[model samples]
Target: MKTDLNQLEPQALVDAFLKYPPAGFQVHEPDNFLAFFYTRFNLLTTLDVALHQKIKALPGYRHWQNMLHLQTCFVGTTVTEYTLLSAQLSAQQMTEFLKQHIQKTRLTIIKDLPLNSPFISEMENNYSQELIKSAEKNGFLSVEGQALAYVPIDFENREDYLSRLSKSRRKNLKRKLKSLNEIDVEILATGHAKFQDAEFTAQLYRLYLNVYHQSEIHFDLLSPAFFQAILQDGDSGGTVLFYWVGTALAGFNLCYEYRGNLVDKYIGFNYPLATDHNLYFISWFVNLEYARVRGMKFYIAGWTDPEVKAQLGAEFTFTRHLVWIRSPVLRFILTRLRSVFEADHHWHQQQELKS
Candidate 1:
């Protein structure tokens, strides 16, 4: 039965998120085992300047500007994710269900399916090929989305991890850390001493907006309440580490612990000072150190900015989405126009040279 997330117990929150999320989600529960819905008004902009301009000039481009995307509540930039509670149903049965029920809905664009994800392993024995075949059979247009960066936390200590980096890169990181000696860093678990400060919460929101507005692609604009809810929701496994220069809050990172993985979810920073102190790099090391000490197997450093992450020795994982259009005309147009929406492979290849 479908139920309000608020009414559920705190421990049930994580399982609900993993198996059937409801908080901040607009879902369609087909059965107790299956649910589907999409977040609306997701701006489909991109960092590719030339491609963005080209797409904007095309006829009927406005229709493609905004999208209805699959719900990504707690997964950061994960684009699209779904939970299937039972293994009794065959893949054909599930696909037919989607076609019969979901295909009639206005939510046509399903996205951000991690090609490497093990969650739906039963449905697609071979991740890439099986997914492509299934999506094609269902009249869905499959396309490659952005690649996510992740750091394998296999090292015993900070130095062990740094040893794998290039000598120059390692030296640069050391220099940045040395320059920021005066700054104090604190990692606060949910309900920690400084976690509930209203003023700090407001500042974090402001800094997040500053970064959001500057980005080329604008999709999900997380609200201030979303920031506070995670921290205060005790069972959310959320934590925020604040970097302070005395009383001033320079930067903060909101992360979560999920199934032995440390996901670096969101980050907010005070402008000029953030750059002056090289807080981005500092936060990178700090998060890594935290993961190492916590004995996490992997540190997932969210999506976008493939270049800098590659320089930091972070490996890349590709994500694909199955876009099903309800209108025949629009489907034809979009099928012919998939290249514009696909990730810029050229830029990623260029970034690879840095590593």
Candidate 2:
């Protein structure tokens, strides 16, 4: 039987990521069997604006904020995929792993623990549930995380895919996609000649930062070295899509082809320009078409913008974060305000009710 590790993000990619992780992230290998990511995290990044401000307005808010500035340790890469343990461990073994890492940081987070995934085996699925139960029993709080969106690439062509959507959605998408005719979209694999241009690579990194700064949630600010590493590694299964408008680079998407799926990863856009061209909608169709044409089974869009992704006819898979907070007082506050951290889950629930 193929192990859970076999179904994870490519091993080579993981190695590269660790060697050049986002800013402030450090890789720690306490033993040969596992790796942990350590970082200083601001807990407020996870909360919505109103709740975040409410916390700020609380008595002793600054003191609480300083206390909540978590020295965090993540069980996995904290990237696109599920938390990948190097090997499947029994509940006892998992508990041991937790015990080893928990005390070193103010917070321990095992992120993207997949509740359901078509990519993993049945054995892995059962083991994951047991891990969650074990963690909960050991005082860990399981919080519902953002939905991982995906699209099955079974359509005959773009037209066939659009036909599956509601009439209004279809019309709107088609209108937006019309912008593609005037833009230049080029696909380049990793280690392409263009990536050798330092200036070009820097421009792409700037665009990524632009998106990051504009986002409501600011967490990991990936470094230039991280981009350089991925772009320069030819064997990493990385593919970049460059969207150009009249000799000017408008945006780019970095994705990967792995295990019969086209996995969408990072995207950088020169906004205002990107928005004017409706690049987001255009790129969605572009990726779908690209995957379909290549005979890939699925387009695994990464987590974020779930409502928009849902509107684009993408299906979603859920995950949970196993959080272990060291402070009892903070833990109590977290349990009482857990709903604030679960905006995605609540939004999904509301959608279900509406439907």
Residue pairs with colliding backbones in model 2 are none
lDDT of 2: 0.82
In model 1, which runs have C-alpha deviations exceeding 4 angstroms? 1-35, 38-47, 53-89, 117-131, 344-346, 349-355
- Which digits, one per residue and each the tens of the lDDT, describe model 1 over residues 261-341? 777777888888887889988898889888888888778787767778877888876666666666687678768877766
lDDT of 2 by residue, 1-355 (tens): 1124524455666666677787888886554546678888887776766778887899988766776677788887755488776454676687776877578577889887778677666666776788889989889999988888899888899889889899999999989988999999999999998999999899999999988888877777888888888888898788899999999888999988888889898899997999999999888989998898888888999888888999999988888889998889989999888888887788888989998
Candidate 2 Cα misplacement greater than 4 A, ranges:
1-8, 53-64
lDDT for 87 (candidate 2): 57
Q: Provide TM-scores for the models.
A: 0.78, 0.93
Question: How much lDDT does candidate 1 score?
Answer: 0.63
RMSD of each: 5.4, 2.4
